[model samples]
Target: MLEVDGLTCRFGTKAAVDNASFSIEPGRFVGVIGRSGAGKSTLLRMINRLETPTSGRILFEGVDVTALQGRDLRRWRARSAMIFQQFNLVGRLDVLTNVLMGRLAGVPLWRSLIQHWPQNDKAVAISALEQFDMMPMAAQRADQLSGGQQQRVAIARAIVQQPDIILADEPIASLDPRNTRIVMDALLRINKHFGITVICNLHSLDLARTYCDRLIGMSAGRIVFDGAPAALTDSIARELYDLEAGEVMDDAPDFVPGELTPAFGNVAA
Candidate 1:
């Protein structure tokens, strides 16, 4: 569903991502693990055409994504969407309205500005929220919802778009244990039930192990490891994260997903 080849990104003189290449098949789940500045975020951004790659190719379902621009880029972006760590949403808009924004690409800007969507769009947004048990809070303002609710709203927004692929960057960085589990379960359910291809970048190796079918490890802007969870060990984690002896404890917390909490309850990223 997604293919990347010889991808590179440079900031001034420093290359943040170097010649990265990978492909994601439909219904496949892959976890991205790497040290900070390992190019994980850059890779995801390039896939969605949100960041301009300094060099290389990005193809989704056969079209060259790097060459897409204007309307082509807009359509492709809607097809391959992203979920960010920030859970970007209008704080004052109601939850349902936030989800409805997913249909922006299809709706006229004037109609969207009026918030007078067609009845079918409303139905689609409501059903998407229902998948995450978010229908009850649809009328609540985005800021009025808890953090977990907000993330669910975000996921619902993604679902409403009916994207063929979902790219999530550090999706679990802020939630508590329960909220994390809820969000992860939701993503897994979406991937399994809807067969949407998923590529997620996660900081927690244990979470990657628990939920991902394959792992892609990175360091210094290049992929160094790609395999199953059992293939990644303490030594491997150290290598991917650029850690030295005793840098990470033996009993590091396993990344079990928990329910997302309110932003006030969000732990430090």
Candidate 2:
């Protein structure tokens, strides 16, 4: 389980996240919903310590990951895998090789640099690919695969890490309907099959309602509503999105408006 307690992140005078608190249990699939700049991504980043919080405690299985530094921090991050929106795979590397890289934290850096993945890592990577039915593309370069395939490969990498929690940030933002289903399907399977806690940052309520066991709504840097999908009323969405009655939309198809380019660049939190 993941416990985020009184989390706060400050950038200069403004707090990107303000005393945010939430807990997720194992095998639970939860969604974080908010308009851009609601501090959703910052909160996720803090989970793995990519961004440090100004004040707060984040306990991962009773260990305060927020207080760790150096080696301890690295270990905590490895325990919780992060899936980026851009599918942060090395395009030049083969899918299998990239997936095996997840074991690098445990392997000696010198050995990893020499591409000498241990036998166990190789078997683990292969098994992860088989789980995703991505074995056929294992030898292919990451750049050669489709967007959905790359995302699966990324998940396979996470699988090999044996993460207790998976943090996905707008994972389907760049995909079409079919690809979106493909990625979300894999995520749901991972959560159910492996009992890994999943906290996904989502743009579409449809996807959230379909896959999440619970949904968390955020606005102006705080979680305004946190509950089951059935409990998400229209008024909650309006308050979350700052929309008028008629203009309010629920579960619209995920879209990436070109103007929101560099999404959340000048995020006001």
Candidate 3:
């Protein structure tokens, strides 16, 4: 459903993403794993056109996404929704209203400016919230929700967009273990039940293996490994993170990097 060819993004003397190329099939749940500065975020932003590539061809459904302009680009972005790590919602706005913002891409500017969504649009947004069991909080201000609740709200907004694909950039990086599971489960359900293609950037190897059907590992802005979660070897994972086997284990109470034994073993506590 999506293909990236020889994608490159440079900033002055540095290249954030260097000739990265990959493709994702429809309804596939894929995970991008890498250490910091591995260009995972830059790669997703480029697909969303938030970051223009220095050189590359991004094709979606056989069309050249990189060549689009203005309304076309806007329309393309609407088809590929983005879920940011920070839960980028209007803090003061009510939860339902924030989700309705997803419709702004298709709605008239006057209606959006006035926050006057038609009943159908409101129903769509509400139904999205209901999917995540967030309807009870619809009247609450976005800022009043907890981190996990806010992330669910963000997912609701993405769902209301009726996107073909969801690009999640480190969606659970800032959450507690409990909240992390909630957000991950939500994404997994969306991909499995709704069949929406989901490409998530994940720091937790265990989480990636648990939720994603395929895993793509990056090193220094390039894809180093692409395969099923069970096929990811310890050596390859260490190489992707530029870490040695001895340094891969985490001693934190909530995480046991040591437990990551055997193929597709639990990567975190």
Mind giving the per-residue lDDT tens digits that candidate 3 earns over 99-170?
999998889899999998999999999999887778989999999999989999999999999999999999
Off by over 4 Å in 1: 244-269
Q: Residues 1-269, candidate 2: write the lDDT tens digits.
A: 57889999999998889999988878898999878888989989999899999999999779888889988887778888999999999999999999988887788898888899889899999999987778988889999999988988898898898888899999988887767766787787777767899999987766777778899988878888999999998767767777532332544446432112231121122
Model 2 clashing residue pairs (backbone): none
Candidate 2's C-alpha lDDT? 0.83
TM-score of 3: 0.91
Better of 1 and 2 by TM-score: 1
lDDT of 1 by residue, 70-160 (tens): 9888888888778888899899999999999999888999999999999999999999987678888898999988787788899889888
Q: What is the lDDT ranking, best to worst? A: 3, 2, 1
lDDT of 1 at 154: 92
Give per-model TM-scores: 0.91, 0.90, 0.91
RMSD in Å for all candidates: 4.8, 7.8, 5.4
Clashing pairs in 3: none
